[model samples]
Target: MRNDIQIDKRSIGINFIDGKASVRIWSPDSKSLEVKLENKSIPLTKDDFGFWTITTTNIQPGDLYKLVINNEQEFPDPASVSQPEGVHGRSAAVDVSSFNWTDQSWNNLPLADYILYELHTGTFTPEGTFEAMVSKLDYLKELGVNAIEIMPVAQFPGSRNWGYDGVFPFAVQDSYGGPEGLKKLVDACHAKGIAVVLDVVYNHMGPEGNYLGAFGPYFTSKYNTPWGNAINFDDAHCDGVRSYFIENVLMWFRDFHIDALRMDAVHAIKDFSPVHILREIKLHVNELSQHTGRQHHLIVELDLNDTRFINPLEEQGFGMDGQWIDEFHHALRVTATGESTGYYSDFSGIADLAKSYKDAYVFDGQYSHHRQKFFGIKAEKNPGQQFVVFSQNHDQVGNRMLGERTSELVSYEMQKLLAGAVLASPYLPMLFMGEEYSEPNRFMYFVSHTDKELAEAVRKGRKEEFAAFHAEGEAPDPVSEETFNNSKLQWNLVKEGQHKTMFNFYQQLIQLRKEQPALKHLNRQHLKVSFDEAAKTLLLHRWHEDQHVVCLMNFSQQEQKIQAPTEASNWRKLLASHEPQWLGKTEAPETFEAGEEILLQPESIVIYQNS
Candidate 1:
C-alpha cells in the first residue's frame, strides 16, 4: 500500500510525510545547515525565503537529531517539538498525531464565564509532572473553576524553573513529562469540562541554551527590557522573526489543542511596524477561530493600562478577548492589607477599590504617583469582563521580599472578605493556586540552572532586584534545591481545620457566581459601588434584569453599624463572612427591612439578594 500522507514543507520543525521526515529550520545568517540523524548526515538546501530544508527517510519519530550549522557547531533544533533530553542535548522527533484526543466536542469557554485558576505546574503538586496533575482534576471540577491558566512549560535550562526562563518556545520541558505528558494533562482537563489556557513568554527567551541568536539576528538592541534584549519584531530582517513567534501562537492552539493563550508581559514587546506584532497575532487568531470552529482567546498581561489591547480591531484596536489588570490587584491589596510601597503607592483606600470595581481600570488616563506620569488611557466603553481581576497572583505573591502570600499578610477574616469582593465583582476573577484554601506555603522564586556561573548570576540579580524593598535577610537563592522543595503546595491541608472552611467558602462563592445572572452578566454599567472612606465601608450593587445582588463590606478593625443602600429593600442574606458555619462568631438576620441598620464585624463582608 502506498502511503499518501503529506506534510507542509513550510512547517518549522521535523514533520513526517509518507514514511519520510522533512526538516525545516530558519537560519538566515548561516552559510549552510545539515541534519544529523542516527549518525547519518544529510545536507539541507537553503531557499530565498531564509528557510533551510531537507527530506530524508532515515529520520523517524523518537530518533535523536541535532542541527549542524556551517560545519562547525551542532545545536538542538530551534523549534524542536520535544526535547526529550536536556536543553544542551539533542532533540527528538515527536509524532503529534499519535496522541489520542477525546475532546472533539470541547470548545473554549466564553470570556464572561471564565473563572480562572492560575497554577505553576512544578509547585502545584508534589510529583511535579503532568501526569500528577491529572489526579487532581476531580478536585478542580468540584471547586467550580471552568478554566486553568498554566504557567509557561517551555524547555528551560535545568530540571526545574518557574517557567519564565524557558528557552525553546516550541519544546515542552523534558522534566515536566514533555509533549506527551502535556497532551494527557490537557486531555484530562477537557474530559473534566475544564478549559486549558497556556501562559507563553514572547517578550524574551531564557539566557542559557538560547541558540537562535547564533543562527540569526533574533534580538534587537534598540529597546531594552528587564530581560536582556528585546525580540527583533520591527527591525531589519524581522519578517522571518515575526513569523517565527506568530507560528508559535498557532502551534499551541492547533497542535496542542489549547483553548487560549495568556501572553506574559506584552508591554515589554516593543514593535513599531505599520502593523504591530500584537495586532498581527490577534488577526491570525481570529482567523483560526473561524476556520477551526473552535473558540480561541488571547489574554495579554500589560501594566500600561492601555485599553487598545482589549478593544476590537474594527475600532483600530488589537482585538484581544481579555487583559490582566494589575491595577485591580494593587487597589485591592492596598485597601485590604495597607501595603503602600512600590507600585502599591498609587492606589488609595476603599475609594480606589470602588473605582476599579466600577470602571474596570482605576488609572484611566490619571496621573500616577509611582510612574510620575499620566499612565493609562480611558476604558469607559469596555465591559468589565474584558479585564481579568485577581486578589492574588504569582507576581503579587511570589515577587515579595519573603514570597509571602496574602494569607500571611492579612488576617483570616480579611482573607475571607477579600475573596467575597473578588468573586462578587463584575470583572472576571482569577484564583491563584492554593489561594482558594489559603495554602500556607510560599510561592517562592525557584530554579535549577545547571551552569554554575549562570546560577550565581541569577542569585546576584535576585538580590539586587529586591534591594529597593530592603528585605530583612538575604534573598533566597533561585537555583537552590531547598527553595524549590519548599514552594510545593501542601495539598493535604485543604481538608483540615480552617483551611477546609475557606475551601468550602470558595466553592460556594464560585457556584453563586455561576448561578447568579447578575454576577455572570458582567455589565460594568449596572455594577455600582458606594464607598464611605471615613467608615472604611463599601456597598456594591449588581443587577441583571430583575435579579440583584448587594454586597456590603467593612474593612475597618472594629464592629460598625452602617446604613443599607437605598435599594436594599426586601433583601435576604445569602452569605456572611462572620457566620459561625464559616468559622466565624457572628451571624446576620435572614431577612431585613428597608432602611434598617446592619451590624458588621471587623474585616467582614455580607452578600444579600432580592428574589
Candidate 2:
C-alpha cells in the first residue's frame, strides 16, 4: 500500500494555508486516527502511505489539540511546535509566519571567526528563561564571543533538565519561555552581531514522555546506545522516522531563524544504510539554506576523530561545517596538571600539547593506552578552523565526580596559561559558561523526571559510574532539585577582586586575537610549535605575511629562561600573564632582542610581537 501511494514530503505536519488548516500524521500501527480539538472529534481519512489527513476550517492558531489513535488512545501530536503544559500535555498549534523578525541582514558566521561560549538555558541566568538570556547579550558581546552555543532546549520531561532527555523534537521547552521567547532571544543575538548555535540530539530520544513509538516504529532494538535504543535510521519502515527528524532540523533553520546546529554525540548515530542519515540531513539543510537565502551551518560533536564529518559531500563524506576536537582538551589538561588517569593516561608530557597544536589531533592512528587499541585516523591536512577546541565544557566538568572545573584543579597562574594556549591556537576556541571569571559553582548533572522508578535508577546509576574516581563522600543525586539549584552560575562574582582581574585578562586575549592578523590567520601552515621536555616550557611561532608573534609559556614551578630565534631581530613585549596588572607579582619587561634569554615566571605565558 505504501508503494502505491504518492505522499507529499512537505505535508507531514499541521499547516495553515489561506485561512484553512490541513493536518497530517503518519502512524502505521494505528487502525484509526482522529483529530481531537475543542471537545470535538474530527475523523481523518487514512491514505495508502499510512498517513491520516484532514482538511477543515475548525482548527486555528492557538488551538490546543491531540491525536486519538485506535479510537481509544489520546496523545499529543508528535510534530507539535509548542507544548505549553509540559511534554505530556496537549499540543498548541502555532503559526510561525506570524512572528516579527528583524534579522533580515544577518548571516551565519564563518568557522574561522567563531569564539563560541557554550551555556545551558536553565542554568545560564538566575531567571532561567530565554528572556533572561536576552538581557545578557550585551555581557556576552563585551566578553568578545562572536557565537553563543546554547545547549539543547527542546521540550523535555519537566521544568528542569540538561536538555539531552528531550522527547518532543519540535516543541520548545515550556519552562524556558517557550517558542516566542526563543525567537526574541535569536533576534536580539543577531542584532548584537552574535551568532547562535543550538545543540540538538538525534541519536536517541528520551525514555519518558515520548509518544513516537506508539505511532510508528521510530526506534530500533537492533542496536543499543549508552542512553537507550537507537533511532531506526536503517531499519524497517524507517523513512517516515528519518523525515521526522530531518524536517525538525529544517524547522529550526527556516522557522526559528537559527544560524547553526551542533549535533550532539554524533558517534552514537549508528547507520548501516548505504546513505547515512547524517548525509541526508546535510543535503536537506543545504537545500533549505539556498531557498531561504540564509547561511546555515551544521556542527557535529564526535570523539571518533574522523575527518570525514568535515569533508565535502562530493568526497563521499558527510558535509559538516566543523566538529568538536577532544584531543586538544585532553593534551592541554594533561600538560598543565600532569594528571594521567582514565582517558588522561594516553597523554602525559608537554610534547602531546605540541603535537595537538601542530596537527589538530594528537591521537591520529596511534595506540591509545586508555582505549587499549589503535584509535582515530590522521587529520593532519584538515584546517585548524574546522576543529573546535575547548579547555572546559559541560561534559568535561559535569561528567566528573565533583563536577569541578579546570580552574578548581590548577593554580591561578596555570589558569591564565591555559587560557592563553586555547585563545592563541590556530583552531576555533569555545569557553564553557562562567569560565571567563572562574565562577566557582559546579555544573552537576541534574534532571526532574516525573517517573519515580526512573529517577531513583538515575541516582543509583550515577553513583556506580563514579565509583572509580574514589571521590570523597557520596556523589550528588542527579534527580534532586538541590543539584540543579546549585549549578546556576554566581554572576555577582565577576566584579570581585581576582575574578575581575581574570575577566580582564580574557578580554585582552580576545581583543588581541581579533585585532592581530597573525592570530586570526588560523592556518596551520603559518604556525610552528615546539616544547622543552626538561625545562617544562612551550613556544609557538605564528605569522601571516610580514606580521609574526612568538609565545613563551613556562609550566614549571620555578622561573626558567627561554630563548628566542637565532635570527637577529627586535621584539616588543605585547602581553604577559605575569604582569602586575594581571594580578601577578612580577614586574613587566619592556622589550627583547633576537637570541635573547627571557626569564619566565612560574606557570606563566608571555607574548612578543616582532617590531
Candidate 3:
C-alpha cells in the first residue's frame, strides 16, 4: 500500500523520508554505481553528469550500506557524520537529532580567564575510561583549571596511543569508551563549570586501517608531509573533503557541547585555495556559535610563527583564535637545562627569554639558522593573549630520547622559577598533566600495534632518532606494554615532600595570577624585562594602573647578590622557592631590603609585590 517513488533521470539527489533513505553519488569515471544494502543490492541510475541516485523504502536509520563504484566496493559516504563502530567496519545511519542534550545553561568561558590543562585520556587514570576520568573532575576544579584539553580521542588501531595516529575522524576510540562515553564526560564537565577542548588531528591519518582512499579522493599527491601524502584540501573534489572535516568540527560543538577545539599540526595542512581550509573552518564555527547562542573557539598549533593564523579573516588572514607558543617553551627549556642541540640551537641565554616574555615570539622576523629563513611576524598591538605558553607539554616530554620532565633534569629551585616565568608571562599559561606536582614519572611514547614488523620498526626508529641528542642508554621501546604502563600518573606522589613543594608552588603561582592586577594585564606595551647575561639572572617587571609586580630569577649555582631595579624599592617578598615557609620550615623572610644588595640561593626565583 506504500507509494513507490519515481526518480527523475535528468537530476540526481537524495530525499530522506519518514522511513526510507535515498542516496546520490557523483562519479563520472565509474562505469557503474550500485547501492549495496544489508540484504539486497539496488542498481543506481546514472545521469548525463555521471551522477547515480537510488531510493529504498525499507532502509532506515541504523541500517548499514555501501557504494560500489566501477565494480569496486567502498565504505559508506565519505562525508559520513558518524562511524559508530570503527573506520574499517560498516558505517551506520545515525539520527543526530534523536539524542536529547541536557546542557541548556552551558556557555564557553572567556579565553582570558581560561587556565587550560592538557591531558591524555588513555593515561589520565588507571581505568582509562571516560567514566573513570569523571571521578577526577573535582581534582581539576581544585587545581583552578577552567578548561580540559584532551588529546586526540578518535579511534585508532589498538587500545593505546597518543591518539595522533587516529584514522576514524568521526568514531571515538573504543578503549577509552565510545561516543556515548565522551558525551557523558562532556556533560559531567559542563555540570561542574569546566569547558572541554578536543585536540583534533587533520594533517594525516594513521597508517593502519585508514579507508578514506577507498571511499573517495580524500588525499592528494600534490604535496607531502612528514606523515605521508597530505590531505587533498586544494585538489579536485576537495570541496567534499573539506566539508567532511568542517562538519566533524561542528559536530563536536553542536552535539557534545564542546566549547573549543585545539587543531594539531596546522602547518602540515597544505591548502593553496583562495579561502584557506582554516579560514573556512573558522567561518563555519562562528556561524554555528551564532545559531546556537553559545560561543565556540578554535585554537591552532602552528610552528611557522605566522601571525596570519590568528589574524581576522576580514583582515586577509587565517582567523584562528590563538596558537601554541612553542618558542616560549623552547626558550624556557634552553634557559633551564642549557641544552643547545637540535631546535634549541636557536635559543640560548636571557635575551631569548626576554623576547618570549615581552613579545610572545622570540624569532619574530629574525633570520633563523635552523630554517635558514626569516620566521614569524610581530604580533598586533594588544595581542598578548594570542599565545599560549608552558614550561612542559606532551610533545616536549614524549619526543625526548627519554621522556624526562623539567623536574627530572633541573633542580627544584629551577622548576619553581620556570613555573613563575610561565604563569606571570603576558600570554596564557597551560599546565601539562602532573607538571604541577612535578611527577617523577616520564610520559614516554607508547603504541599498541599488533603487527610485529611495524612495531619493531617503530621501536628501532625511535631509538635511532634520538642518536642525535647523544642520549644515554637504550630508548624506551614504544611498542612495549611496559612503556604505556610507565606513563600513568602516580597520584600518591602528591603527598611526598618534593612533589608537595612543587604542588604548593603551583597553587601559589596560580593564586598570584588571579590576585595581581599587574599579572592580569594583557598589553605587551605594559611589560618590561631586563636580564644580566653575565650574572645568569633575569627580572620581569609588569605594571597596570598603579599596581606593579617584579619576578626575579637566579640561574647560577652559587649564592649571588644583585641590586634591585629602582622601581623595586618598595618590593615585599611574596613568594620564594628557598623560603622555608613554603616547605613547613619556620625560617622564612617576611621582607627584603629595598634597592639594597640581597643574596639569592642557587637556582632560586623570588616574586616581590610593591606594598
Using alpha carbons, what is the TM-score of model 3?
0.90
For model 2, the run of ten residues with the poorest summed lDDT:
1-10
Worst 10 residues of 1 by lDDT: 1-10
TM-score to native of every candidate shown: 0.97, 0.96, 0.90
Task: For each candidate in turn, give its C-alpha RMSD to the true structure in angstroms.
Answer: 3.0, 2.3, 5.0
Instruction: Please report how far candidate 1 places residue 256 from its true position, in Å.
Output: 0.9
Q: How would you encode candidate 2's per-residue C-alpha lDDT over 1-611 as one tens digit per residue? A: 12221222235567776787878898977899988887798888888767889888999999998999998999998988889988889999877556799988988788789999999999999999999999999888898999999999989998889999999888899899888999999999999999999999998888789889999999899899897788999899888888788878888887788888999999999788887888888888777767877888899999888888788899888888889988899889988888776788789668988998898878889998888999888886778788899889999999887788877899988999989989999989999999899888999999999999999888888888776655567778888889999999999998999899999999999998998888888889998888898888999989898889888999889999888864339888778999889989997477888988888899999988888
Tell me which of candidates 2 and 3 scores higher on lDDT.
2
lDDT per prediction?
0.86, 0.86, 0.78
Error of 1 at 509 (Å): 0.6
**Superposition TM-score, candidate 1 onto the true structure:** 0.97
User: What does candidate 3's lDDT look like per residue over 54-86, in tens digits?
Assistant: 677765776676666677766554434345555
Against the true structure, candidate 2 has what lDDT?
Answer: 0.86
Model 1: how far is 229 from its true place, Å? Answer: 1.8
**Tens digit of per-residue lDDT, candidate 1, span 86-135:** 88889999766567789998887888899999999889899999999999
